[model samples]
Target: MAKALMIQGTSSGAGKSLLVTALCRIAKNLGFKVAPFKAQNMSLQSFITKNGGEIGLAQALQAMSAGLEPEIHMNPILLKADGNKGSQVIIHGKVYKTLKPKEYYAEKKKLWNKVLESLEYLKKHYELLIVEGAGSPAEINLRDSDIVNMAVAEYLKAPVILVGDIDKGGVFASLYGTIKLVGKSEKLIKGFIINKFRGDVEILKPGIREIEKLCQKPCLGVLPYFEELSLSSEDSLGLSYHKTFSSEKNKLIKIVVLRLKYISNFSDFDPLKYEPDVELLYSLRKEELLSADVVIIPGSKRTVEDLLWLKSLKIDKILKYLAEKGVEIIGLCGGFQMLGKILKDPEKVESDLKEIKGLGLLDIETTFYPKKITTQAEGYCNLKENLKIWGYEIHMGESEGDLNLFTIKRFATKEIKKEGSQKESIWGTYLHGIFENDDFRRFILNKVREKKGLTPLEKSYSYKKLREITFNTLAKLVETHLNMEKIWSLIKL
Candidate 1:
């Protein structure tokens, strides 16, 4: 087995994911081929691979840092939240089933064989594997069948690096309590790092010394919060996500997404955030979205509930205003389902809400279906704006609308256009990350300009360049705190 160091946390959002990412980058910088593994991940933020698989965005970031193509082996199990105490379970890039909390707990223990298989795959191939745990393993109630945190590290015999978020307070207590809670002080915990700290370093040294003494663990480093890195977050919850911009300057394209409760895959717009002059804004207030050059409706876990919620808050009126003002409107995935004549969940795929009326901007009707189309598809996109783009489709509904307006050609293994878009200023599609394609990206950027009666910006984007920049920053972050030589030694052993 390759040497390994697991980065576990006292709780969720303790900066474990970012630490793993930086470590992977730093390892690559030190000439070690490193890979990241998470035995289990329960989060809403997900990534669609070029090969049509799904995994958490955190592992994908780690893979990028390691200079490797993201694969299903990185995150063997991705549990996507589906609201009301349920999650869609994904095992090795395949949808296993939709399981309620209790139901999932029962099956998780049985899934360890598969988790071990993925870990072994990485262990044999990569020089090192940086593992991450799910939520706090300290939930004593959940210790019996702990598949994510302490259980996985113990299974792999990997030394643990406990990460605590001091910004939340109780740093010493959290570290001490976590070790006590796990009830296993085998001296396998190599060290610790304090993440998301603010203020003078001199003052924090005392706290760091105190933390080391209280936990009886080496204080590896105290990492101050740095916002300039522009690190893309793995989960939307409490994440400081920024939009991407192009190096070539141009007029700003202000695209505003309405932030709703229970948002599912809002990361679909992360690519857009990087666009130069394309200001991506997320608004929950109706008035705040009015001045946006383009109004977007992102996917929601509960489409019916969110639509009803939007209707209650007059989001329909605001969308209508943006449309009337000649502003561009784009609806993606679940958002596309809501833009049709009606979003009926007779089959209850998304929710139990019988049927809800849509915005009717696309002249389409969506029916919640029993079957899910979780496959990769590609094609051209041109309407009020001309663009040829490629993207992936994973949705649970059938849509019917004007096909001529928005032409869709799925790449492989399926022929279905249950949901689609319009040709005019308004467009809708049940596809996520389709804008990542250059042709599609150019079209949308130009359409935003077209809506504003402006010319398309000639400056283009380099996707590879952006990835490199992100990875480089992450590597520096690791070098700043982690012991690269020690981590590499762990990975090799």
Candidate 2:
């Protein structure tokens, strides 16, 4: 067994992802081949790996911290909520089908084996594997077959450093109660860490002393509340964005994103947001999307349903406006489904609907197929002049675009792999996380600037450089908050 440590949280949103990233950054700095693993994670936000499997975005960020390309083993199980009552569950980087509340829990027990398979694979490959637990291990009802927390730890025989959110109050109870309720036989959970504390360090001394005295575990130390870490939210919750710098002087281009009910992979907007002189905003209401310079439809879990939402929101008018104005309107994955002529769901993968009218921006039709096309692709943008770029493609429905209006060339190893149809000003592709590529990202930014009649900035932030900035900020957080020596002591190798 590789020397392992499990960082479990007292509850959801208790700084678990952040803590795991710290451990990852710190471990790498110590010259250890470290990796981040979360057996299972339930969140509205999800990511598609290179192989076309979805994992938690937090694990993806953690993988970035560890200098490893994102993969499915880092997060074996990803639960994307189709709605409050149901979720699209991806197990072992494969879709096991959608399940409602009762059905999900019924089959939940069987997924532990897949989780173990991934952990076993990681244990063999890495010098240190920092595992992160979902929600809380202390939730007694979920403790029996819980694979994300104690169950995962027990299987690997990894030690745990449970984290408590002091900023949320009840830190003492949360810390003490978690240890009191969790299975004592897991042989995990050797210590505890108090996080997000504010005010003086001296004030937390008594509480830390009391927690250690009661739980009989060492207190790793309290992390003071620091909020300057410019990181992406794994799930689009508890996030507030402000237009710190105005875009009026820079660019007149406006990107209107259709904020659908079950939007899955909205992180595609991160690159757009990172671009200078570009205003990336989402319209929750129908009227907000009208008169957009570039109307973008993001990926959705329920394409047909979100299309209905798009109509109700009157996004069709915005698409028409962009199309008539020669605006660059693009759709990705499920969004690509909506840009087509029609969407057919005969298999009822999403709904019982057979066919529905689409925006018809791109000359195309999509059919929901049984087998999903999940893979990485290298290509150049099929603009008036091709630009070299590479991006991943993750989508279930197959899109056939019209030859006259929309065109894209898929390349692999300096050769043409496949060709995409082009139609008019509308572009559609079955790629989810494409804009993350620097050249493609720059193309979008520069094009948007030209459309808006503004000159693009000379200083462009490359995605690789942006990741360095984000990762380095996270490293700083680790240096200030976590006890580096204590965490290093926990790594077995």
Candidate 3:
């Protein structure tokens, strides 16, 4: 069996995911075949693996850091919140069922077995497994039903390192409380790490000493706050921190993305933030949509529900106005479904409503299906044939439209099909990560610049290269701050 070391957090957003990612890189750098594993992940941000299995985006990124391909075993269970309808549960990268809180808890035993199977599979293949826990292990109320935190650690006999966010204040208290609350599981916790520290570490030494005394666990390290970290967030809670761009005067092209309540795959637009002449904003305000040179409707897990939310906010009317005014409007996945004239969910896959009216910006009509399509796709733009694009598709149902925007082929399959629809300045596609393609993205942006009589930028940076640099930079940061000698000893490396 492979050696296991787990990272657990005091609270959500306590930086557990990134810490695992950093450690994965650090372990890989030391010549160990490393992999990341999470028993359960509740996140909207996900990626389709090479074998067409959907997994949490954090594990996928962590796999990349470890110089390995992301696989379904890395994240055996994924729960996507479907608003009031409940969460859509995915087991081993396939849709299992949608269940409410009570219904899901009833299946805890079965899910726990699946978690063990996945953990065993990883252990056989990897030399070291860097595990991450979901939420806090100290939720005494849910401790009996827990499959993700202390339970997993105790099962694997993995040494646990608790992480607390110093930026959130009361780090010492949170760390102490977490260790005390886990009861018998406290024996598995070997150390504690304080993350997101902004000030001097010396000032925290006294409190750290007290926490160590109280919990009987050594303080591993204090990681400084890194503002330039560009990793994709594991869940929707990080959305607020991602809204760094504003309608600055220096930026020539202003792009506004409708901040849908059920937004998924927000990372689709991360590349746009790197553009020199472009400013990106996520807002639901009417004025922001009206002032944008480009408007985007992003993917959502609950398509019909989010569409209704748009109508309630009167953002539907503003989208139509923007389309008529020749604004470069684009929709992706569920957003593409919402831009159509009508949506039919006859099987009640998404909601109880049989059918609902869409924004009516496009001439297409969409119907939800019981089965979801999850695959990596490659294609070329119909309008600009030289502009090739590749991305993953994760959505339910299909759309019927007369205008086809791109020709695409699913990876590992030879069949060619027409995808997306475009009419004048309005575009809609089921493709996520379309903006990450340099040639196609630049073509769209330059067209906007031409309309404004501004000079188009000729140079574009490679997002893939930037991701590699980011992984290395993060690994170096963690290695420098943390007591790696102790970490290596704990993991038996």
Candidate 4:
């Protein structure tokens, strides 16, 4: 059996995911077989493994860092939150069922056994496993039913490292409170890590010592803020912190992305952020759309619901005007369905929305069914240049239209399809991560640049290379600040 070390946060968004990823990279660098495990993950940002099983985006990144293929056992239980009061429950990389919060809590014991089984399976394959806990284990009211945090640590006898966000202004209090709330399980916590610190380490020494005294655990490390290191975020919180571009003087092209209430896979636009000539703005404000050279509707978790929201906000009309004015309009996945003439969810898979009128940007109709299409795809963009493009499709509904934008083939499979539509300046597609391809992304951007008589960029950023660099940088950064020797000793690595 493999040794396990768990990282639990004082609260949600306390940098648990990134820390685990860094650890995985370090372990890999040390020539140890490492894997990441999160018993239960709730996020809209997901990735499909080579085996066609779905896992959290962060876990996939961790797997890449560890030099291993992502597997279902890494994330046994995935809860994709719907816009409403329910979530789609995915178990062992497949959709098991949907459950409300109350119902899910009642069934935690059943899920707990499955989690243990998955952990055992992972232990058999890896030398070490770096587990991550969801949210805080200190939620006193929910501790009894907690399978993801302290319970997992206790069951596996994994030494725990409690992480707290110093940037949030209550690091010591939060760490101490979390330790106290865990009661008897506090013994499992070996140390504390203070993350996102900005000031000098000397200035924080007093407080760090106080926290250590309160929790009866040594302060493992104080990590400096590494904001420039860009990795795929685990959830919507990553989008919230990103500042929108308001200064158009420095940018040649301004792109506006509609910030949907239920947006998923927003990382698809990260490439645009690195473009020196492009100003990417993700905003809910309609006025921002007026200044855009290109307008984009990002993927949504609840397509029909978010579409209704657009209707309520009257943003749909503005999109139509932009498309007519020759401003490039692009929609992805759920957003593609929203741009169509109509959307029908007869099975109520997404919501109770059986039929609803769309924004009518494309002469297409989508019908939702229980079956979900989730797979990687590659093809050429159906344009004059026939540019190459590759991405994955993860959606519950399918659309039919005549103007095909991309001829797609599922990766590692013989399946092929003519996907999406392109009518004049308006375009729609079901693919996520389409912009990651440098050639395809530049091809689209250059068209807009040509319209404005701006020079096409001579260079294009490689998203794949950027991801590799970010992971390496993150691994080095954390290893420098963190007590890796102690961590290795604890995990017997």
TM-score of 2: 0.89
- TM-score each candidate: 0.90, 0.89, 0.96, 0.95
Candidate RMSDs in Å, in order, are 3.2, 3.0, 1.8, 2.0
Q: Name the regions of candidate 3 deviating beyond 4 angstroms.
A: 238-251, 412-414
Tens digits of per-residue lDDT for model 1 on 1-493? Answer: 5777899888888888888887788778778788999988877677766666788878887898888988899999998887775888889887888899889888865688889889889889987788898777688998877888878888888888888888899987898888777787336787777887898778888877876787777777778877634455656664333354545335677778877776766667766776766877677666657767777888876777888888898889888877777788888887888888887788677777768889877788888886666656665554545455556677777787564534565544556443367746787777776666655677668867876668787647755576678778766776766665665554454
List the candidate 2 regions with Cα displacement exceeding 4 Å.
Answer: 185-187, 226-230, 244-252, 384-386, 403-424, 491-493
The sequence of per-residue lDDT tens digits that candidate 2 reaches over residues 22-61 is 7788778779889999988887566656656767888988
**Model 4 off-target regions past 4 Å?**
238-251, 384-386
Clash tally for model 2: 10
Best by TM-score: 3
What root-mean-square deviation over C-alphas does model 1 reach? 3.2
lDDT of 4 at 62: 88
lDDT of 3: 0.89
Report model 3's TM-score to 2 decimal places. Answer: 0.96
- For candidate 4, the per-residue lDDT at 267 reads 80
Angstrom error at residue 379, model 3: 1.9
Which candidate gets the maximum lDDT versus the true structure?
3
Candidate 4 per-residue lDDT, tens place, 1-493, comes to 8889999999888999999988998888889889999999999989887666788888888898888888889999999987556899988888877899999999988899889999989989989999999999999999889989998998889999999999999888899899988989989999999999997799999887877777679988988987644576767765644344335664468888888899998888888887767777788777779878988999998888899898899898888888879999999999888889989888887777689999888989999999777788888887956678888888897898765888988874667889889888989898888988888888888999889987787656787788778888989999899888887788676
Q: Which residue runs does candidate 1 get wrong by more than 4 Å? A: 228-230, 239-251, 383-387, 404-419, 490-493
